[model samples]
Target: MSASQAAEVVRMGVLGHVPPMSYRNAQGEFVGYSVDMARAVCQDLGWTCQWVPTSLATVADELKQGQLDVAAMSLLSTPERRSHMLFARPYYTSISAWVARPGVALEAPGTRVAVVQGSAQARFAQSRQWTLVEVKTHTELAQQLAQGRVDGLLAPMMTVVGLMAAQPLQSLQLQVQPRRDPELTGAASFGISPMRPELKPLIDGALERLERNGVYDKINSRYLPFKVN
Candidate 1:
């Protein structure tokens, strides 16, 4: 943008959370794959992005309350959310895994599982009829696993693995069960407000271009060590 264009730029809030996807760096700047992706789209659309760093609790509310224009938290495209939000083409995909203390049966009767509230894992846990310990974020999930408060946790594989690698749990012998995803949420994407419907195609076009130009691949490689799909 030119000096004069910067003066008239449309400043919009873009929300994000989590590591590798969106989080504050050592310099306290919001930096991650999702952040870069959002910035790319914003630049392409000739807008100035102000990142709204949000937690699991306030992310949805920030969008609903009109405080944010885009939620770049790798949100899964759901039919229910589609009723009011416009989801861009998926920028990432994820799979679920069952992490548990040793000797606990994952699919057994009366198994206790911790899951993020309102996440796909929560829905999966509900379908299995297990006791649920609903948490608001991945940190809480990792804490629950470390504390032995739940027999197991259902969560995204990479996030949980990263947590385990960073935090060494003691006296809490652990086991991990990798389950074949049963259509349990895949292909997460950025969410745009339905109020700004016109921006969807422009954002989508930028994403398509980014993918074609290897920008998406470069961004993905910087964060994720393996191919999600």
Candidate 2:
């Protein structure tokens, strides 16, 4: 393809999260790491990038329909996902964790862990032998924890930390250990549509450059909530 064709605008889907990516500010603007990273790539290529909000369950369908060129949201690379879409080299590693209300200890066999259905955390919980109660979203799991619907929740350690900081839940706590299988760590990578093979290299190269230059570290630091426990 010519340089102009390569620089054509792409519609990148994203999800709302903490600042420096796709967070909804008090003014209600969506911004954060994924957004900044996507924006940087667009600026470098002089391309116009559009952000589409989507849930994890529907991203694959959207990509398949060609409604999206790429997905900036984080999803684990499973054989199932690989069959339908391509993934960029990992941009961030989210430590999977078991979170619970303060004072409730989480044990392998006896603990009831709430997880988002079809999420990495849910899969990890299954592998770890936790009794799983599948919910729809991280926020929903948090609600269950608040309501005593379950013993604890499993999710990315960073997300647990961020939630604790932003919500200041005295009951919520997180436990993280090195993943035993290594492959189950559930680190995040960008998902690309198979139809847009060209966009993969363009976006992946920009991500590689950003990681090498410490841009990603800075972005993570800004969003990661510091926890004492």
Candidate 3:
């Protein structure tokens, strides 16, 4: 391939801390359900894939600034976000839940809730006028909940479950409220940079092909206990 052609490969950004979905491992490699799916899509299109590790707090800005070609992290489609970037076809269903110690009133006035910055849960907390303890990553959000620094945590249900099984949190007996917030429940899709409008069709087609060929299901099963699509 020519230098210009090689340079045209997609620069996909992924969260560095959200495990089982998209994260950078201990070995410094990006591996997770989202990463696998992105790779499959790029491979199908015969496009080189360059993975960029990023935090959820900055991904949207990065995309809007053209610093990244695609946001491969589990980004939920929202009207507010749609104004900043384009989203590919929906890949998975996203639902968020509240986690807290038993007997803690999550809906009480001035209840401090921890939420990952730039996430849908954060917006939900803000909309409800809940005191927000904004965090940059899922690991920090989990740490705040485990350390009792926050009254509750509002995050994706699957992410909450994954973090609960990790260190510094596994022993804590936390109550997970059922997901019911319409703002936090919706289809998650890849956020394509507005600068790369051409990527929308390419990524959408690749994802559709993967789904039809069962590759999407295989990747989903490899990382999650339940199907997200």
Best by lDDT: 3
lDDT of 3 by residue, 1-229 (tens): 3456445678999887777888777898998888899989888887888988887778888999999999987788888788779999989988988888999888898999999888899988898867999988899988898788899899997788678779777888888896768889988899999999988987898899999999999998998888889
Stretches > 4 Å off in candidate 2: 1-7, 17-21, 102-107, 126-131, 168-183, 225-229
State candidate 1's TM-score.
0.83
Return the candidate ranking by TM-score, descending. 3, 1, 2
Q: How well does each candidate superpose onto the true structure, as a TM-score?
A: 0.83, 0.81, 0.94
Q: What is the lDDT of every predicted structure here?
A: 0.70, 0.68, 0.86
Candidate 1 segments exceeding 4 Å error: 1-17, 168-173
**Candidate 2 lDDT (Cα, whole model)?**
0.68
Order the numbered candidates by lDDT, best leading: 3, 1, 2
Residue 86, candidate 3: alpha-carbon lDDT: 96
Residues 1-229, model 1: lDDT tens digits: 4565344333244333355666667888887777888887777656677666565445555555556667776776656556646787888776778888778888787788888886667767887769999987776787887777888888777666555665644345678777667646588777777766666776788888888888888877887787653
Worst 10 residues of 1 by lDDT: 8-17
Candidate 3 — which pairs collide? none
* lDDT, candidate 2, 1-229, per-residue tens: 3689556878888776533335667886666666666676677666787778776667787887788888876667877678778887777665566666556666647688888776666766777666788876566767777677788877666556555555534444544443334545655777899889887887778878777887776666666544211
In angstroms, give how far residue 137 of model 2 lies from its true place.
2.6
For each of the candidates, give the backbone clash count: 0, 9, 0
TM-score of 2: 0.81
